[model samples]
Target: MLTSIEVAGTAQVPATDVGFLLYKHPDRVQQFATSQGGATVFFPAASPELCRVVLHVDGVGAKVDRAEGMGRYVNVVPFAASSRLVVVLGKVFGDALAGRCATRPELVDNRWPMTLTVPSVPTGGRCSPAELFEPLGWTVQTSAQPLEPPQWGDSEFVTISLSGVHTVRDALRHLSVCLPVLAGAKHYFVDDAEVDKLQRLGDGWLDTHPRRDDIAAGYVKHVRSLTDEAVMRLAGDVTTAQPADDANAVPERRASLARHRREWVVESLARAGARSVLDAGCGEGRLLAELVTALPGAQIAGVDVAPAMVDRARERLQRWRGTSVWQSSLMYTDPRCRGFDAVVLMEVIEHIEFDRLPTAMSSVFDEMAPRTVVITTPNHDHNEAYGLAGQWRHPDHRFEFTRADFAQWCASVAEEYRYRVTIDGVGEPVEGLGAPTQCAVFTRDDSSPQLNSSEGGRR
Candidate 1:
């Protein structure tokens, strides 16, 4: 940690949450990364005589982009072993960032300015308090909101940024770097004037409160509340699609209604912090598109062995970006894709060959690695639930697991996957509601907060 620094030494910047004196130590970074259960991060470092920043990672090499005078983002694929973030920034030869750390710590924010025209705000990660009002100290408190996918082919992007500082100016400066991300919201710092504005807002807001430093926290809460309200309001307008025309459109109509229902359903789940989604034999791209819409910027994806379903998913999600979709059998290998924030395994889990249920589900969990996997199937115990009898059978359902049977199956897998499990079904029992639809929701002990806090949505 010491060898990489320039002779002048680094100035310390105090942070309420993530405070550390940053200095050039490219060499020590490799060691630090290894100590953190992370793979070594190797990237080119700027000349020691000029600027200083440290970089480390879990991969052989990362693509490093320089930050303002110093700092850089070492972009790499996520590590499956752990979620810890590894970053490196510094000057590169013949490029900028070749200087000592700024002496004027006053560049920090104190102002409390609001963004004038933030277009297409990314979900979960709009802007960290630091990036939103750079030059003004700031802080952030985020809550996830579920969304829906319109088309499988649509490209959707969501970013959840954070600012863990005490002043408004600092938050704004941080925001400047992250908001309006399409314009390259990579990195930012606050100047003195902006910092002053933030401090004033903090002082003025707290002037009305018993505690002075409480201003930033209160303001962040208020703003987050408003944001959530706005999202919920938008949700009220979306509903199940009405009946369609053409007899051939029957299947299409059912698909359409399901799509609409998916949006609200996913949103409701996200509000409660559900994780992981499984399209249980997601047919075509219908539910997949809806899942994308419902969970903006989620780490969610879809899988179907049918060539048609895979193609349809790709098409349906062309525009709604971020989450990736794939074509693969639920019965198969390569354990990296299993657990997730949540799983949607909707209608497909019931039909597989009976013996395959345990193995298939285990594979799904192992591949997706989600905290929770949401399951839905008809209530075989309640014939009136769906108006069916023991004699009746759907051509598609090979075998239906009773609530008890399903619970046991899930329990076995939970044990195998090292997760604590819980079960719940979709919809409630109404006096005249037709069939008893059953759903099960599960969560692993290790998954709760980590999945919930991830700045992405799942519905």
Candidate 2:
């Protein structure tokens, strides 16, 4: 099986710089491996008058295992416009999708007139092309293909053509999010990470999309819990309070509180005499950037599981000296993250699954074992203070911890690792409720023989 996509440039905005945008030269044929098989990306034509790019994906052959004897197995893996294509697109055109065009800086921010075509995309009888793209400002044309004669009725696949003016980044973002929804099933398993991917890639446009529910359902394969959470997040109803008389006041207050949280983290690190810091789960490097300004002499490094977030963080800290950003998960032990004097998990723990917390804690405490470790998570008890009772601050959060819950977890981990723990609050404190965010700081006990042996052995 094969699936492919073609993109053509318009006369006014010729696609001459398409190669630069994709970070692949027109003269080269790029091949990437996929779960099913391989994908090849090449430019069919390249010139000022016209430019075209094609992505061709091949499916792998199916083989039966000898262990399962005498049983018939069917390989129903989807190959057309599936998550495989999304993965290939990310590999071949990630720079373009991320809106990075160093060679053609002038075109980075401009919307180019172009035409996009996908020859064989499975719609799964969910929706029409017009219904999905028209509302997103694209002019759509679709043609359905028929299934095999006599054996089956109409096929679920369709050829779609979209013409519009859009930034390459926006166009690719739309395709990456919508293509899997159209396929109706993923090539890989769905998990909370899938929800985070959707939220991150669909950050700007998905919130207001007219077919958001349909899109969310299709993307997550209709897993009720995942779909509901995605939809709630995109709708901005997860933790937002009802409109009050002073709408501006609420937003202003929230911004101030966020600033306070970051400031507290930085001040605490400085007080601990931390000269080197690792910002674990540093999404977009917001706190990392602030740390750069606040502690000009301190060495800074950031790590994130998402490549896109790491890329953004790198861009944000490009000018800062002695600062590094890379893509890596905190769930496993990483040699590069082992020697920092301090590690900050600011506003990150709540997003991790409960089952995975132990691995993350072990990696930080037993493996890296920074002198000081700081973590902050949402205060569940404080939600009601903002008129959001029994609601989480973000949909991607696997579990939010109240003050007691957070403190208990921290104390247990500290005890297991020979460290002393202290807890504090961030943001405004309510009478009976607590602050919107809670912080836990863990310090290695200097008297511990394990700490002394580890340091002495290194010397």
Candidate 3:
């Protein structure tokens, strides 16, 4: 009975930063005790080009008891990669998986090309590795490991090798959620906390995943009630809608606010005479759908980091001509966003860390160099009016900005990128506090001359 997990990869990000991201120094090994036994995490190889972190679990002391009549029999629990290992992985690298790296904040939103290898994973079912990961854009290769006795046939465990381009957080989250699903069993009992665990780890990609139900079932130990609840919640249905006066407001109000934001974004773009648009960080194609209807003749394209979101966007906009959706990260340079008349970041910038905003904005203004850029974010000043001060509207938001803060940032970006910027309020204004949403429209100074080619123009 052996239990061990290895995450080896060459990341496009700095090697030293990888250690900080994982919250473990590469030069030393850290050990933590588990109920069954204990686990050790160490970086066997750390370099500028490659790094390998291994989690080795020793289950020598683990035992299960069985009772027959008055006599009790005890046997050692099988220690192939199981839910225990997943639990340990979460404990060891939880911060990295959650996209929190205080030491190297910029890398939090960065998508780094990586190669991940899990030496042994218990896949009780016959499902192929490709079936589980390929849809998420991972290139997977699996090899079965045989049982000790040839007559016993092959074991449930397999060595998995995966290569893909993903943010470090995305890669870790995928492993955290999928590993337990692949194992198909948990050594410990499952409870309500398990449901919360599944949802938290599966945040961005789970709802629209093809095997979502199966993953949910596996995570909750196939408890039908728990699985049903998780599935409904993931599909955005389980939670009750609060009334408008409630601190958080109702789902209807939230939807209305989103609709208002999208409308204002389209209005600004139209006002600028933008006929070809790029919707950066477009989640689920909501704004893209609005763009199609509001600007009928415009060429619209949307890009998001989550494949599920991109897939949903594609489905939603399939009937609209000159509309396209794909997976991309605004934190990195993307050529597809180039040559657009305008790029819209509707209620998306707040989700990115403050330190990473410069990189993302530069990628859009410096690299893509669109003629106009429209951005919107939650106005923190209005939070108090809603009785939600000191709290963010969304769990993923790194920071909500006040009207002044937003204006200052926009002014700085406009000047740095050689654009004239105007700040405006969106949604219904609240006296001196202004609207619940703040927007900035940045128009490039044609006479200033761009460092890059000016392919931007009204289509």
Candidate 4:
């Protein structure tokens, strides 16, 4: 059970300056008690290149256990980043939230590159993370967390990553208000005082936000009177509010899909005891990043046909000195691609022409055969969820496969290559249609045909 927020700093502002802004000593660990639980604040990493301060709410499990009724037995407060966590944050960082930095007053209004990571925040239906945070000036990235035992399917809770250039005060205030709204509930009763608090936290930005009404309503627990009053007050105080550019809010669901794909692949690889991995069509190396972190001490590498993608991958994996990314196509066999414990092709097969898929897939199953192979692609059957009943997800996608179609193809490949394949769905499962993304995990069968340098596929 965990709930935490990380504040990252850049070289321009330096990590030390963040200490002055927050009025907390970087080296000291501070603890505070809240109505929900105890919160501990400390720096996990502090340097010129990057600085991160983590505020973690602990003792939540014990507190939940002591609560009365069904709340004690069935509540997400212990694990989900709920309104309780936001309230604790406000209490713990009161001075910082008010934009008061006694030691460095000038830094109070300065904007700097900052990123905040909230590991688990419940985003109920009715509003997506992009709709809520984007209007308030933060770029949002979210990964939906699956339910425990997994059979329950994906939960409403998501790990939210927000990045933007803004004063530390603005960022703190944004989270102070938005995180709770995203959580979609308040732990306490809502009243006029709550409206005042919401107005104060959302002072400058809420008036201009496209989802301001939703935010106001959600913040005050959906009490009609309070929501109306809060919205009116927000409308009146518009002096400092800047118009948000709604045109550029990135569609975040695709990012979530990519994350789900990566997590599935990594888990499948780890389950198969894969110590080394190669990402066959590793685009910009998003999967590579996950592999390095998830499978530490294991050899990791990625290959893409595009030179630009390879360059980006190289830069992205620079932090991991041992990992590598190179330019190579999955349709072709390269000696460098063989002999890894696992190889992954994530959201890639769809981009290849249908006729060339066999060649590309053969290169993976026959030539660069690994102990495990994980493949993920968009399920055409789930396209209706995206309002694209008969359309491709991406313009460049040569073809998309329905669940049955994907399964049949995987079965053929597994039989042809002499491997065992298990198919599963990724992302939230749609009723009757299954998950938005389909996955096929292939394990090499030792008793079957051996790996060889086949000449049929491009090299």
Candidate 5:
């Protein structure tokens, strides 16, 4: 299997910097030994205008095992990019895939005009090339080859070329997770740890992708339990909480766990005597709608990073005058978010990458400085109720906190910001399992001095 990445450069910005981002010097040709064969990485064209890095793997096909009856007769590994290719490439570009750059850290987050070429890819007759790649912003082109014209219709493999603007890290991670999904096979054992690998590489994009379920199923080789858990984790709803005691419980009054969580936030906001509220990461305005009804006279606003979500929220809340929804990221400070009596980041913080979590927290607590701050995240302690023990509820979640862990984090933040905090559960508890959602309410201490927006809060 052969795959390559070519980066185009402009007069001002040269493609040579890609070396720093990838930590691969263009002057050197590196080779590594693999179980099936050998893999080599080299730059065929290295210049300021353009640079192309090629990864060539040889002898993998002969070692790959075909079906039981077919034996050594036919193997598609050589002609197709499979999990084996992912393994080789992953080993070669581990640091790049993780967005780590010691020399040029800023370049790791930058998107560049680049083209990715995979000579042969087998779609396993399940999905089209466009279906798998187009949704991720890649413009795809495919060419089919024939084995022997009349005798054999057409080869199952296709040569695919993908062009797009993407960060080197994202591109590497995408290929790492997508190749196995596309080929519909894995050379290694499919186990619980595979889910973590998928999540780690597929972060930021996979959870929101349109073909997430299909990708998860194929990546894990369609293990039913693993597939179910993965799909639920990507959807952020791993479990539908059922009554603890079916025989003794009333079915008529039961509601969704999400609704319960929203209700809890609304109640907490009301109890805090909030006259104005800001809903950070207000996805589709679900909680915003409830907030409007629960607090009629309150000045309420919603902000989200996705423009599509903001547009949806605008339409959802358009009927409610005086309420505004706009697109904004929580990672940076926004003057518009100031002067709110309360701010609710329901199920938001966990979505942030752990490295960036500090910046986001400082933006909300130190920059916005609302009188009351309410936050909620998935409680991993309740994963057993969802049959997801030792696994995260959502693939996009950077980390889910157990009750003790959540309390410790809350206490640290409260102490640093001088806020009185309280912890509670959103969903009904299941004895030792606790609630599926954990909530933390942070109220500014009475004695702590308050800074106005002009002062830029407490910094």
Candidate 6:
């Protein structure tokens, strides 16, 4: 097959090397990707369907350079409408320890099965797997994978280290405080130290010696430093007070701990007077069940990109046969889905790419014209109020927001899409963590000036 590779003028590879090399071996690769200068190479894929792609790194720092710059370094990740396998090859300069290269799940730990180094980028350069995973409902820290280690020492520890430095507890605390602060949220911090022991248990163990031993302590510390503290603090405060009891009370194997968060959404839906709703990106239809109960006559639909998630949601909503779920991309310009009386996107927006937010949100709030839309994104300013450094953050969230950021974005939407926006919080603020959440209620009036108009354009 014919291929082109970019290489430094000073190096072994050249940008304009023209050739179709004959290859007989099954494993022989026809294409190479590199940067001619700092990162001088681009290998166009034969098709978007090809299962795997490759990128190379020349030295030690280059590995970090590539890993830290994954989104900027290699090709954009392919999103699936169905479960399709795709391989990403980070063929490191053969001698480099594979440990330096990390994929999402690998980064949090210090050990791994040692695949060849491929400079894969973590989420959006804003956060890590450790930071985004928990909030979005994956169990990287408290759960298991084949390579999962009891401590931080046993995975691709480099990824976790990139976040910042702090002990596990300190990192989580810092994350709670900082995440909200960065979002311009208010009332985020409150000290749980003075509270009863149960809340402290989740926050205290990181300081224990036996607990801290045998892990990627340094990496753990760094991961803590990178989160939006304000969001964590505020959320923690609310969650503690309300105490997501359903999740904590469930059987361990179902892994339904997110039940508490889902229940909260159900309550919010009732208060909002939602008759019919779309649980965009609903995980297991946990919220849908409550909606079905509360509004028996209401129409409910669940949509998710992950088919497995859709399956779970469908199973949960089976009795309410009116509830339909399809595995479809929510990123389309005209999502082709009907707008409901209400749209609930709880704990899901943080997992999406920010660049695509305007388009996706517009599709729901404008083009489809839902009367009421409720969204909850972590409040960044809340993290700062606690003055804690190092904390809890989810690796999947593209960006969390502060109250001002949320309001500003909502205001912009109102100005652009003709929606009346209101802001509310799920729980009270910590002394300084900021509001745990900045829940925005968007109400649109169709007869108003359209979003694309000059006076309301997204400037």
- Compare the candidates by TM-score and give the number of the best one: 5
Write model 6 residue lDDT over 393-429, tens digit each, in one string: 3535577775556667777878787776666664435
TM-score of each: 0.38, 0.50, 0.49, 0.49, 0.51, 0.44
Q: Each model's C-alpha lDDT?
A: 0.41, 0.75, 0.74, 0.76, 0.80, 0.44
What is the C-alpha lDDT profile of model 3 across 1-459, one tens digit per residue?
A: 233223334445555557778788889999877655677888777777666777777765544323101223343233555566666667777888788999888877766667777756877743457877988899998888887888888866788888887877888788877877787666564545677778888888989888888888877767565687788878888666677577866443123556667777888888999999999988889888988998888899999999988999999998887798889997887788799999988888998998998999889999999999988888888665544567665546789887767766776787798888777776656665667777778889955522221111100
Worst 10 residues of 3 by lDDT: 450-459
Find the candidate with the highest lDDT and give its number. Answer: 5
Query: Which is the winner by TM-score between candidate 2 and candidate 4?
Result: 2
Ranking by lDDT: 5, 4, 2, 3, 6, 1
Tell me each candidate's RMSD, in Å, in order: 22.1, 10.8, 21.4, 21.3, 18.8, 17.2
Candidate 5 lDDT for residue 251: 28
Candidate 1, 1-459: lDDT as tens digits: 111111111234322111112332344434333322333322233332323332333434433223211344433222211111211222111011121224433423322122222212332333333343333333333333234453444222322333332332323222322332222222221112222233333332323323222223222222332223222323332234446664444221112223334653476458647544555466676776766666666655777778777788788778776656676677887444555566676667767888787677767667666666666665465443332346223545678765566556666766777676555444433343322445555565664222121101111
Model 3, position 79, has a per-residue lDDT of 54
Which ranges of candidate 1 are over 4 A from the true structure?
Answer: 1-265, 272-280, 335-339, 385-387, 428-435, 446-459
> 26-109, model 5: which lDDT tens digit per residue?
999988787546888889999998999998888553355443114566655654687878877777787898889987798888
After superposition, candidate 2 runs with Cα above 4 Å error: 1-13, 61-78, 148-153, 239-459
Query: Which regions in candidate 4 have their CA more than 4 angstroms from the true location?
Result: 1-12, 61-70, 237-459
Compared with the true structure, what per-residue lDDT tens digits does model 4 show for residues 157-259?
A: 7888888888888888887787778777655544457777887788788888998888888887675656776787788732333347665553321224556
Flag regions of model 6 displaced more than 4 Å: 1-264, 333-336, 384-392, 446-459
- Compute the lDDT of residue 233 as modeled in candidate 1: 26
Error of 6 at 181 (Å): 27
The 10 consecutive residues of candidate 5 with the worst lDDT sum are 450-459
Candidate 1 has a TM-score of 0.38
